[model samples]
Target: MHERQDVRTILNRTTNTVASIRFHLILVAILAFPLISGCQNLKPLPDGLSLQGGEFPSSEVAFIADTSWIDENGQRQVEQALFDDLFRIIDKAQEVIVLDMFLYNDFQGPVPETTRPLAGELTNALIDKKKQQPDMLIVVITDPVNELYGGLQSPYFEQLEQAGIRVVVTDLRKLHDSNAVYSFFWRLLFKPFGNSAANTLPNPIGAGCVSIRSYLELLNFKANHRKVLIADHGSTYVGFVSSANPHDGSSAHRNAAIRFTGEAVADLLQSENAVLELSGHAPVEIDIPRDHVNATTSVQVVTEGKIEDVVLAEINRAAVGDKLDLMMFYLSDREVIAALKQAHERGAKLRLLLDPNKDAFGREKNGIPNRPVAHELTAAGIPIRWCSSMGEQCHSKMLLAQDDTGRNVIVTGSANFTRRNLDDYNLETDVVVRGHHSDSVFVAAHEYFEESWKNTDDRIYSLPYERYEDRSFWRRRLYRFMEWSGISTF
Candidate 1:
């Protein structure tokens, strides 16, 4: 009886201790929850403006189709025409130029005699223009992902800042859902510790007029993904619905961007200012044109989560009673597929070029069955091909369509054809350029598509190993694992 009483006392005391610990933990969590929530809701203000400058003249703008290439010396060059256009604009900047990009890199040569890198020349030209006109306002807005993914803290960003340019860095964690989760936990365990680390991470530019701000619209993940560069001389809009940052590596990535001139420039500037205000930046007065300027063409700007069903409607319109040439990085949207099929039944001749690694779903490893959209299209008798391994993956989002009457259109931008891209995730920016000039544009894009298609193998329908070489034990194991993941998109 005595031993039993002693055991009961010890057991009761231990239970009481555990209960106290649990209660304390709950209390701590309750207190921390508000802090975490507050951080997640960080809204600095100015709602969609990131920089300050006067609105550009809508009539003087022109749209351009930009290209990427590697020079003979192996330096990546973003379209030469783009650089030339920038030079012209910087020279004429009367008040301000606001530039926002996801990536920016300048490849200065080791020897003074070597021709300046594209970035270097552009930066120098801007600096010279600033020297000629001391009061010219210049502001640069860059995504914080540059700190991790690209070589951002280089001489380019530094030189721009040192030359009296105002630069703002968007809090990247607030832009994407995945980063929000990581940043929340990161701040929880290390509060001030993390802040200090961030401070010491090297600003390269000596931190001139730099501010960190949060974006509420971006928190939803379907916010702004459009890429625009605006200046007072003339504005240009280069839209790609992909991951081509304005950095050097992206200059080599297979991508497409369009430039605009005339009245379309004002619309692009307005959209860019909207993002800036959303990021808590000051707004500039914009001049809206009353009539279409230059050789007028119809252009539609489509953003995710804003329209009821513009994407589907556009696809349906383009695919119906037309010959379609599409170059896609990812294509998993079911409605798009249905519409394409319907179009085929309606007598549209379709040709497709898709990245083999990125199936209709996403990346496939080992021999796992991918949700290959190409297989379905091929079965339906659409002429579809995969890009070759030696070439860079076909990452451009383009749609070229022509009707029986020869009315042609080209839709290009940062948006992919995936469901997440079309409906949920912030992925693309597409502009439908329609006019008499579209025939030439469609022909150029079609030629590129045909070249890529001819180089790829047509047996992507077969299982991974059935068309490839012998696999190791681990490869076989990985294949089984992926097969069981139940994640194929097709």
Candidate 2:
């Protein structure tokens, strides 16, 4: 009995030692993975995009939610002028039509809006274009999230495929996994087991249809969150970079886009084609006409890791008398926060129009990282405002900095200023536009922020920062930890 007791104690000690070593090893891996992945060089865009020109004519458009303003006596209203602008471009396409939208389904979830049938309108437009110009190259590139990451089949994709359009579903595995807490085990243990062959559960997006495998795949928090539309109309090409998603539920959201016509359009197209190539699709031919517009402004299409690099560079360059205007859905990225602080110290007039970080699909959000981050920024004397929104989010990811020397730079696109959105984890696209206020596009972008900020014309799009400020230390730490860990929806 004495011998047996000694043996049991020895075994218990050995088990504890093994457990400790395993825990330490996991901690080391978690710490090193992001650094290792981030250190590597970003993959290059497809060779097809080499024809992009640098100078182009560009215009800006916006959708302001003017419903909740006190000046409006009767009912609230949302000015959704973006879709019509999109339609104008689609109607004028003569040769090639390339669209890479992140959300293109009919899943509105809890607070469904009477959104225009944007999906059908876009589909019919594409189908009509294909019918009219059979030889015209119509390519539709989209993320796999439309099909809930392959748990369900998207009839929208099927329809486009049937219409003979080159539909390329981005292979998400090609991009970095932002939520790697479970991705390691998922890729090894579960992915091998495979997924359900048929749709088996209710769709989480409220489509009344989903599968177990869909939920399983969704646990991998990564996506191609870029929203761009490129139309090459023979001698001229126009591209739009914006936060607006054609998804019905997103129609009510306050969003913005820049309609640029020139060599930059081809560059945007090039970025999309690169995704197609890396996603294992065959190369499609893109015609490049020698096109350069007479304009003082220049535009560049930054994709993948370059988007983060360019945006940070713009922020870091801010100086005294320069104005930094930011309006975003989420802003939990430490790097950006640090940059903004540095810019503020340098005497740059800073204005932040932030989403309250509350409300999602009719569900109340505690304003996780944004509110806490806002509290930190607001304490530092940076004037902030909470976007007055109903069901839709103030989903625009935009930043503008103008120097006293009449130099202005605008950075806007689908990427939120969050770790997951900006850390080269999820695929993103942002256009960096440079010009003076004299440029119409530049003027429109400047006016959009100021109007929304000051509530011009009695349109209440935002409120003071004190309304949703949260200064709890624990919440701030929680947000920072989540962001650092890369476990975030933004």
RMSD of each: 8.7, 4.6
Cα lDDT of model 1 overall?
0.50
Q: After aligning candidate 2 to the native by TM-score, how far in Å is the CA of 434 from where it should be? A: 1.0
- Residue 79, model 2: lDDT of 66
Query: What ranges in model 2 sit over 4 Å off?
Result: 1-75, 197-200, 290-293, 456-458
Count of backbone collisions in candidate 2: 2
Predicted candidate 1 versus true structure: per-residue lDDT over 1-490, tens digit per residue: 9999999999999999999999998898777765674545454422332222222222221333343333445443433344455556567676677666654553211212122245566568767867877888777766644432232355676787888876665543343232344345445654333221233233332232121221211222333344455665444322222234454333334566554444455555665655556567765565644354444345555544322155455456654566787777666566777777777876778877665553211223332221245555666777665543322334577777767667666666666765445652342345556654344445565565554445323212112212323335554454334323312221
Give TM per candidate.
0.65, 0.87
Cα distance off (Å), candidate 1, residue 22:
5.2
Per-residue CA lDDT of model 2 for 1-490, tens digit only, reads: 9999999999999999999999998897777655544422144333432222344544432322212232455344576667677777878888877888888887776767674667777888888888888888888888877887766677777888898988888887656667766666566456776655465777887575676767877878888788888886546677788887878766677888777666676677767777788788865567655454466777877765666677788788888888899988889988889889998998889999998978776677879878998988887889999887766678888898888999888888888888787766677788878888777777777778877788756567678887887878898888988888766666
Report the number of the highest-lDDT candidate.
2
Best by TM-score: 2
